[model samples]
Target: MPRVPRPAVVAAAALALGTLAIAPATGDGPAVTDPRVVTHFDLTRGQSPENIALAPDGSADLTLSNARQVVNVTRQGRTRLIATLPEVANPHTPVVGAAVVLGIARAQDGTLFVTYATGTAETGVWRIPARGGKPRQIAQLPPAGFPNGLALDERRGVLYAADSVLGTVWRVPRAGGAPTAWATGAALEPRNPRPAAKVGANGLRFHRGAVWVSNTNAGTLLRIPVREDGSAGAIGTRATGLYAIDDFGFVDRHRDTALAALTGGSEVELVRPDGTHRVVLTPGDGLSNATSVAVRGRTAYVTSAAYFTRRDPNLLLARVHQRDRD
Candidate 1:
């Protein structure tokens, strides 16, 4: 059974906070933060919106199923299909892209970079023009070098790929150069850790002088200490209680920390930046199997990945009012 979280003990995720705080709850809506943003991308169950990318221009892009492609979300979350990614598709095998979108980064020049997990014969990394264009494979990951995740240091032009199956993190030069091991299994595990290193690396995010990678097998996230010369090692685990984790995002700038959630949560549980976590929000609070979340500034839009059947659930977006709570 999925664990339930008490309303009083939110820990880090308690407040929607500051100018971005979520509104108080009311009977008119569900019992979550106010004006909650649900999936506006209009995707079917098979589309499997694995990874999403929001550019500085406010245009949003997300990866869909197959050795496939990403499409844009527009019309105020209206579900309309506009374009198909020809470059990322192979009609022979359709399920290739449904695995996981581990890394998402956009360059200063506005070129969007995406990294994939699981596998495919074509390539693991691709770049798309921000002005809207088909993605092209800039680098084809090695045969055995299964890159489960990816992130970039846009200022330095460094690309980091998490090698989940092989237990390593490799860096590839964004300008097109050889790939090198940025971190390995030996450097990722914590001494006398609550759990040992089984799968060394997953999920990559570049923030606060570190490359944060999620450990899927361990339900934890790790931050690797990095040097400008492309040298990196396991700094330490940043968060824990991450279930079947995939990707992570920062709440806002000027903060070294991030906001993350379980890509496949059975119910609500609170996970923290330092890897200490417990149940904070659960079924009783009116959330179910929340797989992904994105913040448009302070308002966070989450997804309920329960679209396995043919029917749409038409779930309502809920909010919490601060005044009502007090």
Candidate 2:
């Protein structure tokens, strides 16, 4: 991963399907059809939406790379302009949420953790109130480091931020103290077979106890254990061999079924920890170009980004549910 001097725009324009994949089936379970879009929101265009979070009870939140406005779409599907331009600071003049919140992650208790930047030459990370209110600075980052993807280790009180350009993962203790780097491919190899030079450290989430992130460039998922000191523990592979994996979400208890947006390869991958994934949605097919993903129980939701950047709108939130599975 070269020094990402600026946020890159590798948006998905279209995705074609070869054919529907073979459905997975099991004893007493209905035949598993490839995942499909449950519902979609096409009104949001050019917002540059990237990361997503679903509350413990299934409420949803959206974040964009460039939008400064933290627009809140409630679980009932009602839209609220929670934080507007001057409100978030409009760090990015083009989009106000520059003071705007991009990633909204929630702990089991509904405490919201937000990742945002001032959109200036320098940026900082913030912890915002999920229900509603002003945001507080969690950590101020060094130059050239824009914290992108975020995941919270609720049980441990740690907030993991993927400093995409730094090609590193950093942590801020919710309890206090300072933020520290967890890992750098410079010392250890990225979990992906791709050389370290190609791995983009982005999109992170907690599954079980591991901190998992999408190595966007190498097309792999990397996991590390939680450390009391915010150090990147022994590195390991969670899923790989898939073309591209953007944002992540899990559904079943066995961790047998999880979801992600495959932007490069163009599709929504219904994946297993083993790395083999069944295509649940495609853009050129019946689906749209999905850039990020989230899942809650019976459904999976995907987001397409900035219309000009993608054939899909900036915000296309679609749901994928288990209609049948054996």
Candidate 3:
């Protein structure tokens, strides 16, 4: 991969995503008494870390949305670059300028899958080796879509990606092949039509026999049943009012509870099966533009991307004791 200039690419992504201003969180909300800072990455490493995948040993594989690199953070807080992606070239409009790397997932055997977009016309999902090796293009998304989040069903050998711009979820083979639309509906699109509002389906996760996804622009959580034939069934709403909900993790599968990172709201919310939620962490607790959450045991790892704002990005950990028993 080529060493793309950071300053220019970061600026171009910020502009394209409409994440130029990240306001400081204010007002009163239920916040974690004291969240622990697990790790911190300055501009030197990358900016706007979007998603995280945990290795078998609990190390974190992070996708830098602005820097176009996959970095590994050890349980002890050490960071190392695993791979750098090529600069995204937009064939559509000059407004997009460049593409940024976003979602990531690790396979059982340690292979990594990543999603990136140069424009809606050119989006890619690539596969990279566990240690560090050449990246191979696994799938190319259809035109007029931006692939953001990725989830893999290792047992079924299926990979799913969420497109933020097209409001669609795609299915592909784990070994790299053509992608097909798995699910599509109005619930995945942004509610507001403002051009600056870059929102849609943001995160993809496979949980409890269903494929779950979060809609950032609509502030809704939805799930699609994975049919026995390996196709998607009807889409159902799991929760709503989760404003700016990005990536999230299940806290208790049996209880159907999850911790969602509300990026636009600048807080981490504990969502219930009934569509109700409560703030678990805020900027007061050091969360700035919280993007993704990964749970290991009882500890939840949240990424504060800060996005295009002045606030720097870092990772935070919080011990989440179930508020109410199932």
Candidate 4:
């Protein structure tokens, strides 16, 4: 079961103070202190959208975890079902509908790569065509591995996936080849002592010659150097104390800053290169269990899965606008 932390009274007061202090600006851009939800889409119950990939045409493709489907949301807010994955038997539990489709990424050529886990020993990555067709298995991960997040290096034709259960990262060629264990260490392991904590390395991204990963259970953001041969070098910590950091997106490429979706914490954290961070949005701002973020220009497309919440079980896809500061 997913853990949800109760909002602290003192912390809530501090957030209100922080938000007020950041208000009122003397700049060229609009005066802004917090992110606001511009619009949202309400999905059916149990869709449980996990990750999203932005298309070149300004559309967004999302992975429906519990529904086991891929959907394309057009720029005009039209949603189209792309594909439905075949059901696989769960090996971890006897639950009837536990299999899930998790991470997704679109290559430069428009081909989509997705990761699916059946709560079983058989988990793998599959490739789908640009216009949506039958999914072809590209590579299968090791037994007992639970792949969660995917990152692609389109220039190098390489794809990386994070194995949450195994606390490892796997790499595979985009042209269909064997998956190799790229990196492994204790830093990727889950730090929470709770037996129900399942995630370790939850999200993976390739940025500026490094592979960045988020550990949901450890509340850490780590950077793994990429060698010339595409192999991983020594791992380094970029930020910590980020609770339930799920999937994040780069906010400022030049500054090496990112916005992370803290699922259990019900907040989106803006993390800097120096480990400094602050909440940019929260449940009070209509971000209940925000799971993933896809940034385009100054707007962030955030998904609220509300996985373990009873308050709002509907899946929401919302936009948060950020103003430029002079």
Better of 1 and 4 by lDDT: 4
Which numbered prediction scores highest in lDDT against the true structure?
3
Ordered list by TM-score, greatest first: 3, 4, 2, 1
Q: How far is candidate 3 from the true structure (C-alpha RMSD, Å)?
A: 5.7
lDDT of 3 at 6: 48
TM agreement with the true structure for every prediction: 0.68, 0.73, 0.86, 0.83
lDDT of 2 at 71: 52
Residue 54's C-alpha lDDT in candidate 3?
Answer: 86
What stretches of model 4 exceed 4 Å from their correct place? Answer: 1-45, 90-97, 120-122, 193-195, 311-326
* lDDT score of residue 89 within candidate 3: 55
C-alpha lDDT of candidate 3 relative to the true structure: 0.75
List, residue by residue over 146-232, the lDDT tens digit for candidate 1. Answer: 465567787778888877556677778887556776687743432212121223365577777788776655556677777766577
Off by over 4 Å in 3: 1-34, 44-46, 89-97, 120-122, 322-324
Residue pairs whose backbone atoms clash in candidate 4: none
- What tens-digit string does per-residue lDDT give for candidate 3 at 268-300? 887766666777788888887788988877667
The lDDT of each candidate is 0.48, 0.55, 0.75, 0.71
Pairing residues by index, what is the TM-score of model 2?
Answer: 0.73
Candidate 2 local lDDT, 74-187, one digit each (tens): 555565544532244334422122343445577666556666655553355666565767656667665445566788777777788776556778777875447787776742
Candidate achieving the largest TM-score: 3
